[model samples]
Target: MHSHPRLPPTALEDCYSDLRTDSPLDDNSMSRLGSEMRHGVTSVSNKPKSADAFFDAWIAHVNETAVYGKESIDPTRSTSYRFIWRSWCKYLASSQEGPNAPYTMANPLLAVPVDVSRFLASGMKGSKPGRAISDVTRRRYYSVLQRIYAFCASQAWMECSPLDTLAQQDIPMAEKHTGSILTPQQWDACTRRYGNPAGNTFEIRDHAILMLLFKLGLRPEEIRALRVQDFQIGIADMPTLRILPRSGPAQERTLPLDDQSAEAIQNWKRVRKDLAVVINTNKALQADFNDDRLRAASDTLFVTRSSMELAKVPLLNLVKAHIERSCSEAGLEMPVRMGPQIVRNTRLIIWLHSGLEVDAVAVMAGLKNRKGFLHLLDYCSESVKQKIQPYRRRDDDPVSVTNMLKE
Candidate 1:
């Protein structure tokens, strides 16, 4: 729960310099650099003329110094932290005695655990009334505040982190739901509806993506990060997928592709190449599209119909949309949530039930160890249990006892 000390400005300068020297800053880094610049100017405005300006400046300072400088934090994580902090600021501004009040603006950091707890329990602005935030969200809220207060304490801005008293026990998490994994029947029904690669460009892309998730056990982000070069189809052995390291401690792993998955990818690749040529030929369309991202056209496998690299939100939307359609077509109710994860869980469960060794399954699933696969045990059916029974120790197995009395 304790926050690490902030790196000195000089240290940050050196870090940024090293990053720049290693490779050109990607869009993510450039965005962070812009925020850092804003923070540098606003950090000096400690005594801004108005309460509104003071709060803005304080928030900016927190983002620049505490959030952005942490090289270990990914861009997605950093964005989430900033968003949670901003929500807190918005809640305070709406309060009568909050920091936005003319008298209290100067002492904006004067928050206690009680205030934080209330904020966590309160309904979010756009959410339904009486629908308090979930415990998981509450825990995240506590973490953001804890980190912010720890940073404040490190700066001597506050005496201590009020969240120090808060424990994991304070927030009651929901029990893990085993039903999140799709039943075999449901999986078959859904796949039968949309797994065909003979459809149009969008259909071909969705089919390929779903195959990667359901057949290859790939996470959504992994699918998004995949480049054309990552596919090793020409190998005489077997087609393989090289998953590059991105958001986790796990090292990059290469997984052999199943026949169906390889074929689905090949079908999509043919269409993707044709689409890219068309998009690149239209100068006006190409210019308009390329203006969005800093990088030139990438070799990423999944992309928009216009051939730009696929973004996170749209990729998720594609998964959800296809799943919903498939569920409707199959005359079955869609799972409460349908995403790439359901496909991944289903695939992993199938692998386990198919009698694949746990270590081998873990490697194919891009996990570091067998321990990470333990949670998926819930998805194992009686049939799967029967399959794995031979691997389990028997209760009546003879116990090995070493004799101490040697001749």
Candidate 2:
């Protein structure tokens, strides 16, 4: 059993007692959550002035900045960025205050080294959901902290960013954490079970969405942002989808569209037309159209019958509900956990099984590297494993290894 470090007699006992319980992070525990920043300034500022204040201010600043452009900063990512700052504050509060205090505050967040180590350790343990975070994300978190401290120091907030000294510390790349995807056979089963009815737009649309993700390996946001113009039937009559660039300035990709998905898209487009006046002409879309840049945006992509506005979460939930309903109808075990992106993994595995090169598969999936693709192999079924096995190499001898000439 781990004992509490050198703390006060009563506090030390409390820490140790709390540690004895299996759960250190109880929701009801006040100390674990940290003090909420009370806004009315104390004589020295009743509000928090130390680490928490800096992070809170930065979050507000960035969120406010996100509103200026035609494309707002992603709300989900902004929420996460805020949470990351809060996590930092939690780390700071729990650390030991050394003999010599550099600042006026009695306690600083964990010492720079300690928190950095803790963050890296937390990443390695696969504590974060959606599989473990990529090494890039871990590195970004660390770098973001270093910047936060630098920002504080520049403002004379703290003597220095606690992480400034960690520059020399080697931060190793984290192992890739891959997600699950359904196979072609599994997908065929899912679609047959869910879709195929005349008025089953719900199932058909979802099945199509899943198909698009599997066939194209589109990112969630890219899939969500799809518009009517993104669909194109090539001169050879091949259906194709133009996947727009993601967060950064990346090249858009034109992915081949499957026939079933194309038929589903046409169905959705028809339904979208019927519901346009009812759903698409909402205040939000009108607001969107007010901007010249957003004027060309269409209302016929993915949307909910509940509302005209294209909300990411609501659409995702609707898709999941349809899936569950289909599972019930088909007598298949309902997935306890699933997401829109699992199809991307399915596509990656299929590509590998079809003997496509890793680089080609990466390009098709819009992945910048093969690391995640390789990691995804872990989730593949044994049949897919066998299917994905490399073929025997052949030598060019101009002679048949086996001749049927033997009498």
Candidate 3:
């Protein structure tokens, strides 16, 4: 461990300026950044009296170590976090300039406790365009700041941390769960009406997505991350879905697919090509892409083709659209809050009542740690208890998904 007065910010400043302006540095300068960190550094910490000095160093630390719910082996997505932190720094740099300047930046590190919450809640204006992030995105932003500030406290940069000083009302609470949980009866109505698509723009794709969320309980990111090749089904074997490591909390894991869900996916794959052709030829859709990311890696199960909405908007909003349509077409009532999460919770609760051991259910639900699993305790009250039955392998029923699907 080492502790000393902060290195002059210019040392880091000049390094990045040269690297950025020069448009790629020589081997020596590259080495200096460490493989551009430790020369392959996994960890480093610098305690700065002012918060500005902490930005680059703290980013490097998270690049080396961020994990999912304190459980994933893969690090948190560094690129996205860096862009976000840069915005925070700009916000802090401009903080003292605003008429409502919250505090002096005599030492910005020291002012974190007083100013961070305000900065996050404030929406972007001008060049950035649009309103601030949604509740989901806001939680992610809070998590990123919390991670660094926690480190700041460990290095004794600030006493405790801003999060510790804020009153409960001041802190952002976990976003509320979307609407009520779906009962098996409601889900039956939703799923039963949606058979193989007859005629719709993305009917096959929509049905496949609903099956994954409602039947298999995958998160939206997990579904979006799936590749055309991730679904594996053979003549004799039941289908399985592989959830790959994605940008956010989704970690790599595979799940068993129920018979109906697998069939739904296969049906989509048959027509998936037609949609790809639309994205390829539709100038409006093609123009929306700023990069060749989707074109270059076209294997993703749910291919994204536009910035009409941001990274997640297309998928998340589509779930709401499809589920609402599904329920309406079937003449069933829609949940007050419509999102993929409600679709997922319905299926997961079904697993719980099916008597899959709680631990097994945790793994299936992608809950890597107990803290992530504890929230489910709310649905486990006594009234629900009488309905849950024991689970087992029937000697005659070799297909697990079939038995699991039997309600």
Task: Report per-prediction Cα RMSD to one decimal.
Answer: 18.3, 17.9, 16.3
Count of residue pairs whose backbone atoms collide, per candidate: 0, 5, 4
lDDT of 2: 0.52
**TM-score head-to-head 1 vs 3, winner:** 1
Q: Candidate 1's residue-wise lDDT over 181-265, tens digit each?
A: 7766678876775555788887898888877777777888889889888888765858998999886657389888888888888
Residue 234's lDDT in candidate 3: 57
Give the runs in model 2 whose Cα sits over 4 Å from its true position: 1-176, 183-188, 193-197, 200-204, 249-251, 276-290, 293-300, 325-332, 374-377, 380-407
What's the CA error at residue 277 for candidate 1, in Å?
6.2
TM-score between model 2 and native: 0.50
Give the lDDT ranking, best first. 1, 3, 2
Among all candidates shown, the one with the greatest lDDT: 1
Q: Please report, in order, the local distance difference test score of every candidate based on alpha carbons.
A: 0.58, 0.52, 0.56
C-alpha displacement of 403 in model 2, angstroms? Answer: 53
Judge candidate 1 against the unseen true structure and give its global Cα lDDT, from 0 to 1.
0.58
TM-score of each: 0.50, 0.50, 0.48
The TM-score obtained by model 1 is 0.50
Alpha carbon RMSD to native, model 3: 16.3
Candidate 1 local Cα displacement, residue 90, angstroms: 21
